[model samples]
Target: MHARIADRGRLRKVSTRLVHEHQVIAVDALTVSDMVKNHRLARAISDASWRERRGMLKNILAAGPAES
Candidate 1:
């Protein structure tokens, strides 16, 4: 539980920094559901948490520039 919380905080910080550093962020179109169907890659994909990070990026971008 604690680890998950820490990981989320780190992901948010990283996402914020990336947004601040780059004007445009491009990501590949990935069908995560299909990708997760493959047992071998499922764990790796979930561990990477790409979906959550992408959502974070979108939310941060929509929120506009962060207060200094």
Candidate 2:
């Protein structure tokens, strides 16, 4: 569940730093459905964890108006 407590509370600190570094990026994430169709890249893409982390970032941005 996305609402489930974040992993050991580290996500927030890391997410915050990432936001600062990227400056409120509006990433165009790949469609995992289509991505998973390719066997060659599926494993690599899933291992990267970009989708999950991106989701977390979205949640943060949704909750607050981030600014420098």
Worst 10 residues of 2 by lDDT: 1-10
lDDT tens per residue, model 1, 13-53: 99999999998899898988899999998999989999899
Model 2 agreement with the true structure over 1-68: per-residue lDDT tens digits = 44445452566667767776776576785788888899998898876667667877877777764541
lDDT winner: 1
Give stretches of model 1 more than 4 Å off.
none
What does the lDDT come to for candidate 1?
0.91
lDDT at 20, model 1: 94
Tell me the number of clashing residue pairs for each predicted model: 0, 0
lDDT for 30 (candidate 2): 70
In model 1, which residue pairs have backbone atoms overlapping below 3 Å?
none
TM for every model, in the order presented, reads 0.85, 0.58
| CA lDDT of each prediction against the hidden true structure | 0.91, 0.69
Least accurate 10 contiguous residues by lDDT in model 1: 59-68
